[model samples]
Target: MSGLAEILHDNGFKVQGSDASENANVQRLKKKGIEIFYGHGKAYVDHAFRVVVSSAIPDDNPELVAAKELGLRIMHRSEILAEILKQHHGIAIAGTHGKTTTTSLAFTVLDYAQKGAGVINGGVLYSLGTNIKASSKPGGFMVAEADESDGSFTNIHPKIAVVTNMDAEHMEHYKNLDNLRQAYENFVMNTPADTGVVVCGIDHHEVAALAGRVSDRKVVTYGLLPEAHISADNIMQKGAAMGFDVLIEGKRYAGFRINMPGRHNVLNALAAIAVGIECGVDLETIKKGLMSFKGVGRRFIRIGDAYGAMVIDDYAHHPVEIESTIKGTKGGFANNKVVAVIQPHRFTRLNDLMDEFAACAMDADEVIVTPVYSAGEKPIPNVNREELAKRMRANRIQNVHVVKDPEEFNSLVQTLVTNGDIILCMGAGNINTWGQFIVQQSKLKS
Candidate 1:
């Protein structure tokens, strides 16, 4: 929503918003001179010409209610984003995970090649230091993250669409795994038929199956599997850099390097590579873009050093994302034990996917479970940290412990951690605040 605000403000629209509370993302917009209110009420949006909000906003929300009463031009976030996309040769990246990184990477490739690509990402882009960047030429080209949580991503019909992988996510809105998969299928199927192509990761069985469902649009596949049209080999981690050789239908292009970790990230890079190729960028320039790429914020980002251990943070709320993040952080070269600090985001999600969540953190030598970070959702019965820890214990995960609050979490990090341990904090909630708190506690604030 902030990305939309940024882009709209850049496009000469006066954008002001009201949030229930302030956070890093809101702070970024404030730095850009965008006005944001701390609390919400009808008076906030009373004078506004149009009020924009995501699907998560309740109907009873004060501003939304007032907007309807006033009969102002109210719009959904996806609608505004879709309207922005229609203004350019847009590329919409859709998936349960990796949307932010892939969107950032695709923009990097185009920006490096001087294609003047704009970006609307879920996370802060390290290269631009912001989530939204206007295209160098108006309506020239752009890339955006297509959200699927409320089945609203179908509102966008871009020239190019990329699906990193499809997983069971946002089940509260989706209700079931099949419905979620259908949404992803609709995302690609909704793209412009005459000129659209969906870049997909074929390694995921469901996403691969989704490709078959889209007959009118061209589907480009990339992954570790040989069957994929675009695949990579000789993947190695060099300190923090990952090097791999790209293969296009048995044709090899050697020495593709990205300054990020994990095979999952490699797949992300491949998706961006496919985007670059479709944009008419040469392989060498695409390689240069990948080499110069920094990374997205909060995806394995280092927040602090506590008790001689490096603390990494990521927005990995789902089981699949957590597994990928841990496996990526391991990176096959570190001797240090990986300790995953898992915070269940919502009670409903924890209640829904207890089995998958329990077994996802095993790659870590130790696991610290935190209290559920309810994003204003009501709690579910029997869906607490101790129960989750019990499930993890059933999986025989080593050293699983549950921490009730930030104080205990900080105590454990500073006192018990080994000299060379890697503490990876993963969640979609206030876990980032915990990372920041640890940094402040350790005087590691940079």
Candidate 2:
């Protein structure tokens, strides 16, 4: 939503909004001359032409109530995004994970190809230093990260649609895995049959199934599987970077290296490659763009050296994401002991995937489970961090600890980590601050 505000403000719209509290995004919008209220109130909506609310916002919000009472236009964030999609050749990246990274990579590739494209990414692209970039060039492309949490992604009909992978995510909205699969199927089918294409990750069973049903449009499958139209081979890891060879339709296309770690990222690059090729970008340009991408914020971002240990922050909330991230971290720092500090995101998710989360953290040498972040939902009985730690221990995870307080977790991490160790902070919530706090404490001690 903040990214959308920035894009609207750049396009000469009088954009002003309110947040519950001030944060980096609020400050960023303020710097862009967009009025940002620190808290929500009815007065904030008095003079607004239209009120835009995200999925997180409730109907009872004061500003939302004011908008309705005043007969002002009210729009969901997805509605605005859908409208924006119609103005350009849109490339919408969607999935249970990796949407932000893949969308940013595609944007970088298009920009490297000298195509002045506009982008609305879910997270800050570290290279661009922002989540959005608005292009003024005529007939240019617009790349966006499609959010599937609320089922609003079905509103978008893009020229090119990329599904990095599908998993049982946002179950609160879909209620079951089958429903989530159907949503993705609809998203792919919504693409224009004549001029649109779907880039899918065939490694995932659900996504591969969706691809099998895509007979009306151009569909490209990418992964390590030989059946994939665009497949990666000869994957080699060097330090924190990964190198892989890409094959397009059984012919080797190019060998590329990305600064990101993990086989999942290699799949992400393959998706970008498929999109770039479909959009007429040369293989060399695509390689350069993938190599040039620094990374998206909070997606395995190295915060700093802390007490002789390297601290990395990542937004890995789901069990699948957590497993993949831990695997990547282990591959990157093969010799270093991995200490995972995790804060489960929401109560509903924790209750639903407790056993999976416990099993996912098995790769880490030491696991520190923090209290649930509870984005907004009330806590579920017997679904706290201590129970999660107990489950991990029962699963034969050697060392597991529970720290209910963030400050205590920081102190515990300081004592547990040593020189040459990798401290991984994983969550979708404010656990990134734990990484920052550790770095600050390390600097203070130094």
Please name the candidate that would achieve the greatest TM-score relative to the true structure: 2
Q: What stretches of model 1 exceed 4 Å from their correct place?
A: 444-446
List per-prediction Cα lDDT, in the order shown. Answer: 0.88, 0.89
TM-score of each: 0.96, 0.98
lDDT of candidate 1 over 1-446, digit per residue (tens): 88889889888888899777978778988987899999888899877999898888889998999999999998899998888889899899988788988998999999999998899998888888888899988777889999888899989979899999887778878888888887887888878886789998989898899887888788899999999999999999865578999999999999999987788889999999999999999999999998888888888788878777788889999999999888888875478878899999999889888999999987888899999999888988889899999999999998999898887888887655777788888999989888777767777523
Which pairs in model 2 have colliding backbones?
none
Candidate with top lDDT is: 2
Give the root-mean-square deviation of each candidate in angstroms.
1.8, 1.1
lDDT of 2 at 372: 93
Clashing pairs in 1: none
Per-residue error (Å), model 2, residue 290: 1.0
